[model samples]
Every structure is written in structure tokens, then in C-alpha cells.
Target: EPEVTQTPSHQVTQMGQEVILRCVPISNHLYFYWYRQILGQKVEFLVSFYNNEISEKSEIFDDQFSVERPDGSNFTLKIRSTKLEDSAMYFCASSRTGNSGNTIYFGEGSWLTVV
Candidate 1:
């Protein structure tokens, strides 16, 4: 079966530099989302996108963050400026639709480590 794939399973970055996490969501899905787990915190939704533009974004998705589908299969999240608090496991998920019954598939996660 096809699955979501994330790159650089772990990353070490400076506190003020930029970072881009990459993901390839499952094909045939229309809705894509980015979520982050800050060490012991709950998974926080950052943004949801479909049909090219953002459909919904949480307060966590501030001016420093952006996302794009660079190609048919690649979706990337860019953090303009990183912080120590930005270290977390970034997960990429995709669902065929927005319905509750649709189970979203998540990557193993890209672990971001900032210092």
C-alpha cells in the first residue's frame, strides 16, 4: 500500500535559521494537512490545503510559516525563521475528503531539533 513519506527523518538546525521539511502524501487524496507535536504536547494543526490554496489554518500558522505543493507529489513546509520552541515532530497527512470517516495517513514524521 502507498504511504506518506517524509525526508530527513531528523534535522538539527540553528535557532534563527530557515528550514524546510518535505513530504509526499498519498496519491488520490485531495486534502493535505500539516501538524506538529511539540515533544510532549498534543498534535497541533498548522494548516490545511486543497485545490492549491489554503482552506484552513490555525493560529500556530503564523507569518513565519508557509507551505506549497512544489510538484505533483511533493509538499513542502518552510519556516522563515526558526526558534528553540519550533523543535518538534512535524507530521504530514492526507485524506481523500474532509469527512470524519476518512482516515488520514501520516508520515513517520520529520523530527526538527533546534538549538
Candidate 2:
């Protein structure tokens, strides 16, 4: 089975810098999303994209954050400015159907660290 792929598995940046995490979910999946885990914290939802638009986003997705699907098969998450608190493992996920019955596939995760 095809799986989600993420580039630059790890990143290091200074506070106030910008970072971009890339992901490519299988072409068969339609809805794509970005999630994060702050070390020991639970997986947190960041944003949901469908039809090239943002369907939903959590409060954590503040003004400093943005997401894009420049290519139909690839999705990207951008942080306008990085913060020490922003250090976390970001995950790319996708689901063929956005229904309760369908399951989503998640990427390994992109680790981001800020100094």
C-alpha cells in the first residue's frame, strides 16, 4: 500500500525564523491534514484541507501558521515564525473519505526544533 511521505525528516531553526514541512499523501486520498506532537504531549490537530481549501483548524493554528497544497499530490505547512514552544513533531495525514467510518493515514512525522 502507498503511504504518506515527508521531506526533511528533521529541522532546526532559530526563534522568529520560518519553517516549512512538506508531505505527500497518496493520490487516492482526498482530504489532507496537519497535526503535531509536542514531545510527550498528545497528537494535536493543526489544520484540515479539502478541495484545496481549509476545512477546519485548531486554535493552535494561529496567525503565524499557514498550510498549502501547491500540487494536487503534495501538501505543505508553513510557520511564519518559529518559537521555542513550536518545537514538536509534525505529522501529515490523509483520508480518502472524510466520514466517521473511514480511517486516516499518518506520516512518520517531521521533527522541528527551535532555539
Candidate 3:
């Protein structure tokens, strides 16, 4: 089965540096999403995209964050300025259904560490 894959399995950034996490979603999937789990917290949705535009986004996806599908299979999430609080395990997910309404599969996660 095809699965989502993330690059730079781990990342360490300075408090205000920019960071971009990359993912290759399933080939046939139509919806893509970003979610974060802050250490012991529950997984939280960040944003969802489809058809080249954002379909849904959470409050956590503020001015500092953006997402793009620059290629057929590649999806990326960029944080313009990282904060210490931004340290979390960022998971990229995809599904055949639309945003916020599908049982998406997640990557192992890209761990972001900011200090």
C-alpha cells in the first residue's frame, strides 16, 4: 500500500528561524493535512489543502505558517518563524476523501525541536 512519507525525520531550529517540513502523500489521495502533537498533548489539526488551495485551517495555522503542493506528490509545510512553543511532532496525512471528513493515514512524523 502507498503511504505518506516525510523528510528530515527530525529538525532542530533556532527560536526564530524558518523551517519547512516535506511530505510525499499517497499517489491517489485527494486531500492533504498537517497535524501536530506537542509532546504529550493530543494531536491537533493545523491545515488541510486540496485542489491547490486551503480547504480548512486551525487557529494554530497563523501568519507564520503556510502549505503548498509544489509537485504532483510532494506537499510541504513551512513555518516562517519558529518559536520554542512550536516544537512538536508534525505529521503529514492524506486521504481519498475531502478535508476534515476522511480517515487519513499519517506519516511517522517529523519531529521539530526549537530552542
Best by TM-score: 2
lDDT of 1 by residue, 1-115 (tens): 9899999799999989999999999999989999999998999999999989899999999999999998999888999789999999999999999899999999999999999
Q: What are the lDDT figures for the candidates, one per model? A: 0.94, 0.94, 0.94
Lowest lDDT sum, 10 consecutive residues, model 3, at 95-104
TM-score comparison, 1 vs 3, better candidate: 1
Instruction: Please write out the lDDT profile of model 2 over residues 3-113, one tens digit for every residue.
Output: 999977999999999999999998899999999999999999999999989999999999999999997778999997799999999999999999999989999999999
Summed over model 2, clashes come to 0
**Model 1 weakest 10-residue run by lDDT:** 72-81
Local accuracy of candidate 3 as per-residue lDDT tens digits, 1-115: 7899998899999999999999999999999999999999999999999999999999999989999999898999999879999999999999988736667999989999999
Runs with alpha carbons beyond 4 Å of true place in candidate 3: 99-102
Q: Model 2, which residues run further than 4 Å from truth?
A: none
RMSDs, each prediction? 0.8, 0.7, 1.4
In model 2, residue pairs whose N, Cα or C atoms come closer than 3 Å (at least 3 residues apart or on different chains), thus clashing, are none
